[model samples]
Target: MQKALVSIAVAASLGLGATAAQAAILDDVKAKGYVQCGVTGGVAGFSAPDSSNVWTGIEVDYCRALAAAIFNDADAVRFTSLTSQERFTALSAGEVDVLSRTTTWTMSRDTQLGISFVGTMFYDGQGFMVREEDGIESALDLSGAAICIESGTTTELNAADYFATNGMEFNTVVFVDQDEVVKAYEDGRCDVYTTDSSALASERSKFADPDAHIILPEIISKEPLGPSVRSGDTQWFNIARWTYFALLEAEELGVSSANVDEQLGSDNPAIKRLLGVEGEFGAPLGLDNAWAYQIIKLVGNYAETYERNVGPDTPIGLERGLNALWSDGGIQYAPPIR
Candidate 1:
């Protein structure tokens, strides 16, 4: 079903001729000397700028990994901060080459939108956060409270569905941007702020008193947040998807940026293939044989990116509950390089 929708979009993209199917986006990026990545305006642990104006987060690292694969330099990427309502339009209109703004993969988006999701980078779920003083122990306690939510996101629908299912009634205060939602919630415009649990954690970290707010225990919906590209370029799609897989594969093979050089000398077939030591993996993707190597050398592996950005020690303090490796009893599994 998904393939059919992608085919329709891909066919539309190829309306010119066979020559147009070569994916000029990659060449365009190379000519510009940087990958244009769209990111959220100010979600701390996902994609936000520091005081130095440098962007850092799990999503930022994904874009950096793509730059490392192509330019052999992780910093060869730039970011455009986008609001939820403007993200897809920016990507579809050639304003950005890739969208790494913590977007959820949904059926309507997959089939209706002219974009294709690469793969899951961060697994999240819809959740609510309330002031601790409210004494709201559960979602059931918010029967008549007003909720602050961001527009043009799945959060609004999820909240509606959850409330209706639980026979609870609530008022909604919507904002076009996430920052507005957060500000309104902070200013006490609403009694509850609802969104992805990870985002709630990220937003709460920026509050004057982080401990004054608490996230409820209910997870309302599955949100597999990942990067995406405009449809119709198979080569670019493969490049983005494989770059993400390279991160996961590197982690699974015990490879990190600190030790990737040593792993290049490894005799294991899997390691050799992953490091582009014995396989012609990069030729198909129009990249160098050392493409994956450069990614690890510059951006590190999935575990490194996660731990450095939003892991247990970070301000977000997200644990590897479901984002861990499959071998470690989590669902973060990747296919073999071969």
Candidate 2:
């Protein structure tokens, strides 16, 4: 009886030891020395390769921010281009650390797919783009129009739901990639193209005559596009979430890539906390104290990133309407660094 009891205690200790060995994702990423960021093949304002084959966009910035936080080097990231069909599978199987592509945070994806969307980096909506000659003022006028959209995306289902709910009819020309959809739309094979409003603007700008297209005024669905990770890693989720909020907070506090180094010595308490001066915020995530500072110094704040990539001065020319800070009547809010 004594021998049997001792064996049971030994087995329990082994089980506990095994459980402790499985650390959270943040620790795993730190140990690995770099982050695996999954992104789309190409989307002009969100994720795309330049002439030098360097990826740059809003989504790309998020990946860089994560790397900067973890390794204090924004370039310490390996970007893996993924299609919509492969994104969730890759994330679930741990092929990528985070999916920062323009993936919509939806109920089915969050609860059913075993992934957790950290937070919204870009608050978007589904909209349509039509040729100038089409005279379509709103999505309501798109009835009977042949629409071009990418398959295996939430946009497809949202398009169907919008048409069905409005009692309208239309034919869809589906493709596996945004480039194909854009080609089909530009070739006059489809009357209109439906996608995220940002993407619609991007596709419109690529046209031979940019002025020949107009994005309709109607936004049909809410698309909170953001970063995502596997569901089981709570620590990683918090790290991703706080990193995003830090960007927004930096913007609110007037920190920028151009001036981050100067602002690091400022007297503001909040700034110090965010810059790793007064707090040990990074230690819990297995990162250095100056993690957020590195991100701001290397990647810039959210506003700077937006302006450089997709803001009013760029070809994408997006205004900071809903993406502005909460103090400025936008929904983009961040928690205090304390």
Candidate 3:
């Protein structure tokens, strides 16, 4: 009978393609998503708080968007900042509900850390940053340069790998956290600063003289950053995963918070299902059809969030290269929200 209900639901709702399929509102996933990051001060576009004690960033908005999805209220989340060394342990120990700390999803973290990734929210790559006066035009030229990086991160390993593979030797000016890494680099303790290309740009944006530095053009390692939950909780995983994908699908469907009400009357089948207009698509997941609707209406679709928080017009100003929808030139394709 359960199988029959699910099958009927799938058929009736037209397959909720890339949509989050209204997941079950398990208490476990609910508690899991009530997440907090290590520090809200670093990673300008990913997570940071502003002068008014209000938090805002890509990762911050993601949490807000997710909270809206789960509880229908974006502000229903509480946060505690963790450091790089403490984030994973905190998640596993149930210290945070979700880890949206701009963390890279790697095999070790996935299989070994007892955590699971829902999907890739941001596709990035490791790169180097140097002062404009350094005359280091390419990563290939950074022979024997001291590079600043945060420990307890894949960035350290990736930096070593890139330098070794390129037959270049480099010195690592390691720090305990991202803030330390950035400060050490800014103080000229290291000849170069390295992290994801996006992070290099983000860090550079905060510099006293942002134009004094330049991020090299070369990308060293792929960094697929996203949200993570404890491994054993399937319900939480489903909810978080679908909630993220729903953002992408909403963007693809032209659903924006500003226009969501107008779209409630849309005749498009896909739009109807997404906005809770026609089918009970969210029923099986123990959610009302408005799960995605609330997310879209409150936090907006993927592009909207990205453009708002990290787009080219923003301080972080990331280009929608790989993050663009598959329909566009990028690989950011979400499953159909049937």
Candidate 4:
């Protein structure tokens, strides 16, 4: 069924438009009074369920941000936990409204999977992790080592590419889920673990002895992770994409949750336009003018979500790095709300 959907979508892109193309998912979500969001099942600081089965993470905040934009309520959202292999399938099958997991945005996935990426929520790179006791200080020493990785992710290709480029031979232990990959590495089934660098930090933070594992300094491939929605619905696409951009713009303009009410009386044109006090930007997308305002009011800004979930203070302990505001020596730029 997934393959058929992909084929039909590819055909449509090639001028073989299908008559059964889907209507706006945005309408369906509104009619349901909530947004169903797909999230990673176990990646710490990105998406994970607590003991009560309640989800909270940076990506979870993204889903909440969307809910706030639409419903003016952050809690009016549902989370569907998914593995790397199942995330895209669940999204394309309409099992979820939006995929806010740590899914990388790539050309093949965007074009061949009958899905559209909203925007990059996190900038990451592939790296390796190994036990500190292994006497291995760098990825270069893992030539003959067995590496554990999750299948159905860009990490697979990246691992292969990096190994081949360096003329190194290594055994690959692939798993259907990240949990198994982490477990396999923990159980000594593989000599090394590889994934997005931040993920390596996240996974290691969960270990019984985090200090025993060291992430190698080599960052191999770019992984721009973000949310995605099924294609054939331009309105839904716009809503998801702009929801992310709104958060970035909010951070860039210093319009945070605390000062948003105060900024309403200010004279800054960018702040006024972003909060919908001066423009009709939301109307064209079937949203009210206060869409962005509601998002920040309920879910806060991008930096707030990041700091709370995976910042240097969190157990995952990730710095903003490349995810900082564009004006602050980072690449996290967004289109103006105007």
Ordered list by lDDT, greatest first: 1, 4, 2, 3
Give the per-residue lDDT of model 1 (tens digit) for 80-115. Answer: 999999999999888999999979998888777888
- Report the C-alpha displacement of residue 52, candidate 3, in angstroms: 1.9
**TM value for model 2:** 0.92
| lDDT for model 1 | 0.92
RMSD of 2: 3.5
| lDDT (Cα, tens digit) per residue for candidate 3, span 211-243 | 999998999889999988877655567777888
255: Cα error in model 4, Å: 0.9
Per-prediction TM-score to the true structure, in the order listed? 0.95, 0.92, 0.89, 0.93
lDDT of 3 at 279: 81
> Candidates sorted by TM-score, descending order?
1, 4, 2, 3
Q: Which 10-residue window in model 3 sums to the lowest lDDT?
A: 16-25
How many residue pairs in model 2 have overlapping backbones?
0
Candidate that beats the other on TM-score, 1 or 2, i.e. the better one? 1
| lDDT tens readout by residue for model 2, 95-160 | 999999999999989999889999898999999999998787888888899999998898999999
How does each model score on lDDT? 0.92, 0.89, 0.82, 0.90
Which of candidates 1 and 3 reaches a greater TM-score? 1
Cα lDDT tens digits, model 4, 238-323, are: 88999999999999988889989998877999999999999898887778889999999988889999999999999999999999
